[model samples]
Target: MKINNYQNKRDILIVDDLPDNLRVLSEILIERNYQVRKAINGKTAIRAAQLSMPDLILLDIKMPEMDGYDVCKELKSNKKTAEIPIIFISALDDTIDKIKAFEVGGVDYVTKPFHVEEVLARIESQLTIQRQKKQLQKEIEQRKYTEEILHQSRAVLSSVLNSSLDGIAALQAIRDNSTGEIIDFRCLIVNPVIAKVFGKNKNDLVGKIGIRKIIDKIDNNLFNSLVKVVETGKSLSTDLYYQCDSLKYWFHFIAVKLGDGCSVTVKNITSRKETELELKKINLDLETFSRSVAHDLRNYINNINFAGNLLAEEINLDGSENEKELIDIINLSCDRTMSILEGITQLSQLKSEPIKPISFNLSPLVSEILNYLQNNEPRINIKFMIQDDVFVNADRKLLNIAIENLIKNAWKYTKKTDETIIEFGEIKSTEKLWQEKIKLIDISPLQFKQKSIYFIKDNGIGFNSVLEKELFTPFKKLHGDSDFDGTGIGLSIVRRIIELHDGVIWAESQLNQGAAFYFILATD
Candidate 1:
């Protein structure tokens, strides 16, 4: 049988061996605006139905090779065509035959020479029921998919909450009955880590009101902060110290409001607090020891200088040139020793001394120091290249000390040369150099307006650059006393003075090639 366009119509298949019976059913269904199909034999009907599944099937019980019962059985056995509603119309009208038809997955049974109206009614009823069954099936599958997604989400949330290192707990606020004001909080959920800190199992803490059991163990501040967060809906954080029996701990508590309750996280900070206190005590002791040592050594050096002065006066004038040279050496040694003691005393007091910053011209100060050095050493030829009106805001006395140390070191190192040149001038620093200096000192560069890069360059014999790291360390000498005379504390003092004024100092040099000491001071 030919098929018509069934796109907008429910399809119905009529199966029978008699062509007349098939024609009659198809005429009735096609007149009702349903796409109709016809199969003459049971095997052909099964094949056609499987190829294009129909909304309903009308089968004749007795057929050529395969009967309607066998056809229905075949269709029901296969998953694809099993749900198509089957109605049997056959001449075997016995009660047993009708019962057998339904037993083989037939929906309704009609007698042979059936009424066309009855057939149409039965077909409409079955189609309505099939649509309802499909809709219900779709709902069931969708509900199953939704339930699986919900299960996976819950598993992920559970894993994240349990895997946290900090102690975590969620609380529900308990309010007064009459006033509707929050009176206490009941624990809703708690991670295992928090339960361990309180010395209890996680299950035991759930649904508990008021943590009276562990109240004395932890500081009351933690509870108060949580209460405040719940009432005001504001977050709070603080450090708490806990001590119970032999156990002592420091805890940092953070609480944030959530709905009518709050969530809290706790971390132990005992080791960190202990380390800070220990370091504080060590620094205090070291400062006290340094002050005592510096005082005693200064007095001893003063006495030695006094004794040396007496020896120089008592020495005979008509002595060997070597004898006179020995006397000169003793006097020079005494002066150097006194200078070292003074440097130590100055360094020891740097921390205690308060900085009194004032605007002062640096050019005049450099000139003054150079003039004093010239008066002391008349034989050496000295030259300078100082910048005019180089102003700086720093402690006048400290700045003077730093400049004097730099110039004196330059003069001492260049003593062997016929003509010595010491240049004191300011150089413009690039943004890259300023940034690097800020990083070295670990301070904010944004606070500075402009930096004054001053350098004290000398045409003297400079040491190797490899020893630059140890140059500013106390008692760290690069050259021996026989080669260059110094106490090795001058540069250290200069560094300290510059640091006190929020400045940085460094040097660059090579063997036998002149050394230049550079310092950066903030102008604003």
Candidate 2:
């Protein structure tokens, strides 16, 4: 058997014991542009088909050594060539049972001395059917793959919806008959979270249209906004207040449109609202207390200062140096006490005021504070190292206070030192460097991070590093009143200001050496 021809043509193998029969069939197939293989016996036919599988096989039953029925059965049994259509060549009055030919995987059996037209027709018909089966099988496999992908996607979506912490719901808009205006929403799909929030079972909520109506009644704008989202395909996010008999609640919700429906997520914010109200009440009390302390205590201190001045002018203290010094001490006490009270009042006001950040150059602000300090204390000599063109996004009024307090502290602490120096600049850092400890190690070699880190370094009498953590705690101080003068509230106020701007501030200090403050703002 030979099958060397390789082209876009159908292949057929013809088997017979007679050389004439084999030659006749091969010529007829070749004339029809069919690649044909001739075999004189069953053994040669089976080997040829297996080696290079033909689309069809023609077998002769009365062959020597091996028969057509056995060859067809052998080819059918093998998985690779099993589907090749096999047609038996047999006589009408054959020794073998004709019914048994088909049972042995024969598609059709031809009579002895078969006609050329009849043999060609049988081969064409079986080849056509095989092509159709392959086409159908390919379509079926593609459909199965698509169906599996769809199933997996649905499963993942179901998992996300069910596991969400916030209440999740899918609602289809119910429109009016004439205007097509959405009057209400019908729950199409709801996750377990939605069921829990609505205080009902998930199964019960589906297909229900009244749940959203009850919720919409709590907030005047909720229904209208939901309808708008579905109609315009725009998203809506807002806070809603709901009150019922002996029940009050606050919820933050967002709605996004999906075709004629909307997907919504609701989060309970009742605790947050309650806390805000409580803070408001506390702020009111704090404001009143600050006013009373300012008015009542301020007048008493003013009277002491007045009386001390009058006594010093009225008395004749000739050779009475001790008496004059006592009077000076009383005057200084009154001034220091008033400054402390003013610090407390400023601290309270900052706590209550809202912060609004704006971009501005920082160098000028630092220079102004430094000039004010130097002008007031003309005898003191201090050097300032300020970075130019440094812009920061922070509340102007609040930042002024923070910078003033820090610079004032630097001035006070460095009074005894041989030379005073203060530097302000930006320190670029990466996320990993955010956790970098401020030790004796240099930081110039570190790579820049995504966010800008700023630092203020002062060559002043620094506090012990052991007390650094407590430095931001209210009313906590490291140095005593005889050594330094401060209310110990400035650092705490600075900490609060940093937190409000979504930033962090930290410092490293060594006693009698120096201190540096590092901070990062997260406005972006």
Candidate 3:
């Protein structure tokens, strides 16, 4: 129905030797919103008909170079323009001329000085017939395509059912006459695997006793599941353990509704189940050992810290310069070691913690972080640009930590520069952006789905491109600790947090020009 109303107007071509006739027909058709093309003679009319292929044509019986009858004959002979409807409009009213018009493939004849209403009525009737014919042709082609697809699908399904290793059976529901309840299931079809599992030939199993009779020997749950599938037309699956003839076994059963019955599949998973139990026991033992080691290490660090403090207090101002310097170095080393231990502990805890996502505005959070950084380093010229009301759904605490680490890293790297420029905002994904950022090789611009891409850009002494791949690896450092102070775990923690929220983060940078870190958060 929608297809029938696709086009708002039809196209008409009017052919005549007289200029006045062409002008009059063109004006009438154009006024009705029908596209009109005109030709002064039959030769031009034939060329126009072949080029544009108008829906309908009006031709004069008498024309220069070629008559209307000859033009119609040439058009009907060509396959490209054969189906177009043609109506003759001329002053000739003799019966012979009218007969000749019909013989030359004209659908209708309109005498000259014809009534305007009659001409319009005829055109509308011909256009309506043409539209219906086209619709019928489309329906025929669609039906053929659908039939071919159905045949292919059936072949694929049959091959899969016959070749599967798992036992498969198709059952038809047998209902009680009076109660309309599913009493049992009769085996309509069974693959070779199913026959072998039941210790019977395939031919002997088809159209045999109800499946309930066989399954009841092991467990009644299988029968009940089949009954449920029939009643609700929904699939059911379960793992079953049973013993038959002094042999123990485990089976995974699945029943799915099909037509008036259900199809069932059974797979033996005894070996896989045993392997899983063994692995679970091994993991429990490893967890206990790790806890014991961590407890002992914490105690040792605490005792060493206390002893160092006591030694510092006992050493007086009269002590040698070298002795004092060595004591100070020992104390600083102890503190640094403690800091590294704390970072590692936190990183490990993130793996076990569950994330709680909530909706919040990102703009205010970024503003707060910037304010804190600015207060601590008042002399640094740090500028930031953030969009307003940028909302996201994520774990607020984890996101806060990630953003803080990134901003701090930018600040530290840009310390040597005269002015530090840090910009935080959103940008749309377009074809041009995709070409400019070649690192995004896997993502297409069309797949962005209108989601915002947020980035933090800074003018800093960026790292070498060769070491970019190791930026997110734990304890991976490109520079010496004295040059830049960090535990080398900040980016790794940031990456894990982003992954937990089903997001992505990547960076692009040059040696000393600048660096930009881009990320996307789940908006829904």
Using TM-score, give the best candidate's number.
Answer: 2
Error of 2 at 23 (Å): 6.5
Task: Write down the TM-score for model 1.
Answer: 0.52
List residue ranges in candidate 2 displaced over 4 A.
Answer: 1-56, 60-84, 87-135, 138-165, 171-187, 192-215, 223-238, 244-246, 256-262, 269-331, 380-382, 427-450, 508-513
Encode model 1's per-residue lDDT on 134-236: one tens digit a residue. 9999999999999999999878867876998889888888888999976677888788988888888998899998763364457655666677898888898
What is candidate 2's CA lDDT for residue 150? 90
The residue-by-residue lDDT of candidate 3 on 1-524, one tens digit each, is: 65554356688999988888888888888887788888988889999999889999998988878999999999999999999999999899999999999999999999989898899999999999889989988999998999899999878876886898888999998888999888887888888877766667888878976567777866877788778888898898887786767777677888899887898898877777667668767755665565566667667777877886777777755667787787787777777766676667667667656789898888888888778878887745667787888777788898888888788878778877888888887665554564455355356544445556777888998888778889889989777877877778888888888878767788888888888888776542
- Worst 10 contiguous positions by lDDT, candidate 2: 439-448
- In model 1, the worst 10-residue window by lDDT is 434-443
Please, what is the whole-model Cα lDDT of each candidate in the order they appear? Answer: 0.83, 0.81, 0.81
lDDT of 3 at 152: 93
Clashes of each: 0, 2, 0
Better of 1 and 2 by lDDT: 1
lDDT of 1 at 46: 88
Residue 438, model 3: Cα distance from true site in angstroms: 6.9
Model 2 lDDT vs. the true structure?
A: 0.81
